[model samples]
Target: MLMIFGTWASQVMSRTLHEASIAEKYEQWMAQYGRTYEDNAEKERRFMIFKDNLEFIENFNNAGNQSHKLGINKFADLTMEEFKATHTGYKSTQPKSSKTVSPFRYNDTEDVPSSLNWIDEGAVTDVKDQRQCGKGITILSFVSSYY
Candidate 1:
């Protein structure tokens, strides 16, 4: 019947429009991050990850109570495991030594402040952002704190 055909056509049209919108969004995200893929398969895989990350970001931002918000960055296309494995720096290949347990030394629990702020007391350094590679901010901060 004509009515059935119209309903099916409208559904198909809506799906097509949705797909187009998603593709456009992904394209814009890729452009913003200067991303590219070697092939369609890889692109599709990364696109799915990007979509999931976007959804997470949106949900976090939509929450009523939050101190900060998240945005799409250069690492948006990576899965959580893949991101941790790649960005977590070097891994040791050495064999493990025998474990040893030590008894507790500090027995006094009184006269201690509820909170500590080493940064405000000039005992520790402040937090810094490392957007790029090979700047050596962490160890340098520790050394400067002592020096």
Candidate 2:
């Protein structure tokens, strides 16, 4: 779970950082004064730092606790949340027959409703999709206090 969290968190953060860097550069390029050599140089420097930070994050996944100094604990926490949303208790699928209740599958048959309704019922957000927000997984994780 930790490994999965680390990988996903790194991917999300990397993408976010890339987007932010691009936006920042675009904003600078569109300044009213127009672009200057020094402005370009400064932008490049900022981009380099962004790139290095992303690389550091990627390397941190394998660096054990070295990333903690860089405030990666929050990233790790986010990764764990993403992992829980997509995985955790996902191995078992709901059974087709009424006799067996599949703990894994959200919706088994017509009789039982899926806990997935929680996501659907709540206000949708950019952060998560309805199917990805598995209520059962959240419950188990919460009770177990894993994260």
State the TM-score for model 1.
Answer: 0.53
Error of 2 at 88 (Å): 57
Q: Report per-prediction Cα RMSD to one decimal.
A: 9.3, 20.6
Quote the positional error of residue 87 for candidate 1 in Å: 1.4
Q: How good is model 2 by TM-score?
A: 0.22
Clash number for each model? 0, 1
Worst lDDT run of 10 residues, candidate 1, spans: 138-147
- Residue 133's C-alpha lDDT in candidate 2? 46
lDDT of 1: 0.80
1-147: candidate 1 lDDT, tens digit per residue = 999999999999999998788788899989998899999999999999988988899899999599999988888899987776687664556665878766766655676666666777788777666665534545334322211
Candidate 1: residue 139 Cα off by (Å):
4.9
Q: Per-residue CA lDDT of candidate 2, range 17-60, in tens? A: 98887566445543633433357777665445544555666677
Give the best candidate by lDDT.
Answer: 1
Q: lDDT score, residue 52, model 1?
A: 90
Q: Give lDDT per model, in order.
A: 0.80, 0.50
